[model samples]
Target: MGKANDVQFERARPRIWDRLYPYLSILPALIIIALFTVYPFVYAVRISFFQNLLTKPRSHPFIGLQNYEEVISSYYFRSALTVTALYAIAVVLGVLIFGLGVAMLLNSNIRLANGLKIIILLPWAIPTVVAGLMWKWILNSDFGILSGILYSFGLISSYIPFLANPTLAKISLVMAHIWKEGPLAAIFFLAGLQLIPKELYEAAKIDGGGGWRLFRNITLPLLRPIILIVIVYETMTAILVFDLIYVMTGGGPADSTALLSWFAYAEIFKSLNLGHGVALAIIIALITLVLILIYLRLLKTEEINV
Candidate 1:
């Protein structure tokens, strides 16, 4: 009877462990996320409601919604909002078009495609600050490589100041952004393209569909999901662009590239108004959340249609 009881205990022990295994496996990650992500988010939310300044660090009085009100009424807020909207639109379009073109080139069986793949990630692999500084020098008015090339080829009489003029500074920022971000977008598009069945293209061709017809009917419809994701991601990235503006133009040329995120940084670091900075950050978070919700709705609708 003792031996029989021992055998029964061993079988029950295996069953009990199996039931708790999934939760046990995930416990460490949950603890880490709670410590890092959850804590900071809660702290920021608390800061947004109070008057917290580094200069007056000892006194953090709870001002209710005063910080939010001040941030909204600030002089630069409207200008920053307008600039951010325009920048996000331009960057999203540029990234999508550039990425799609590269994805097509990569998908084709060309002689240079292999060489192209090896170098495609160089722009994205580098740090954003390093990339911005490199572009700053490359577009310098006095001794830029691009200006030198253009002058050498007789395209221009002299080197143009790429980041000195308001319009040119905006254009230069977009160009630099596209160069740095286009590679990752290309990788995403390439993944989507590969998932498409070859039989679909062959069937379209057999049905008398030409190149444009095949792409419009098959590729575009199938790529809709990826396009939605890319647009949303790129829009968020553009709206929050800071490091490039910080390193390259420094929001110069009359604040042409003073995006909302950069505006928040200036408020905190340059002006030393931590309350305003935190308030702006909270507003940014809300804007981003709204945009994400809209895109997710569209994605769901597209799925239902399909």
Candidate 2:
């Protein structure tokens, strides 16, 4: 009886190990995530409830939600919020239009389509800081290539300060952002366009559908999912934009380009107010989370309707 029991126990040990193996394999990754992401987030949240100024590092005192209240009630917050809103809206629309147009053009059998398909992704591959620097040089008031070209063509009396004027600065930022991000969106759209069956277009043509008619009915409907994805992604990217602003504008010319992220950055680095910065960071995170949830709800509704 004792020998039989030992055999049964030995057999069950392997079964138990097999059941636990998958989680054991991924335990290291879970530990790393807890250390890096989860721990930092919780610590930051705790810090936001305290007066964690770098200058007074040894004297952090619990201040509850004062940091949140102060950040929200400030003038800079209002201005940054407005600028962020405008930037997000313009970027989303610009990227969508540019991406869809480029995708459609690439899908066509034009002579330069192959060459363009190769070159279009270059901008997306470059780092954001590098792209911003390139645009800064291109838009330089005194000796920019664009200014020189315009001068040679007699299009302007002199070089324009693209980064100095508030309105033009906003426009220039939008253009640079679109140029940097539009390529990925175009690739996404092109992939979606390719997946669409040629037979559907042929059938539509048989039913007397022209370019606009076929696009409005067939192409647009089929690409709805991709469009929603692009919108959500681009919206988040636009909201969290910082590197470009740092490299190009520095939130300059009267804070016309200061975004929420930039505001948080200024609070943390420039002002050395860790609590306020963390509070603002949490607010930004919540805003993005809400937007993502809304977009996800829309995506679900779309899927159900289709």
Each prediction's total of clashing residue pairs, residues at least 3 apart in sequence or on different chains, is 0, 0
Estimate, for each residue in 204-288, the C-alpha lDDT of model 1 and write its tens digit: 8889999999889998889898999899999899988988999999998888778889878988998888888988998999999
Which lDDT values do the candidates have, in the order given? 0.91, 0.95
- 25-78: candidate 2 lDDT, tens digit per residue: 999999998899988999999999999999887999899999999999988998
**Leading candidate by lDDT:** 2
The clash tally of candidate 1 reads 0
TM-score (C-alpha, index-matched) for candidate 2: 0.94
Clashing pairs in model 1, backbone N/Cα/C closer than 3 A: none
Give all TM-scores, in the order shown. 0.93, 0.94
RMSD of each: 2.6, 3.4
Q: Positional deviation of 86 in candidate 1, in angstroms?
A: 1.0
The 10 consecutive residues of candidate 1 with the worst lDDT sum are 1-10
> How well does candidate 1 match the true structure in TM-score terms?
0.93
Query: Model 2: clashing residue pairs?
Result: none
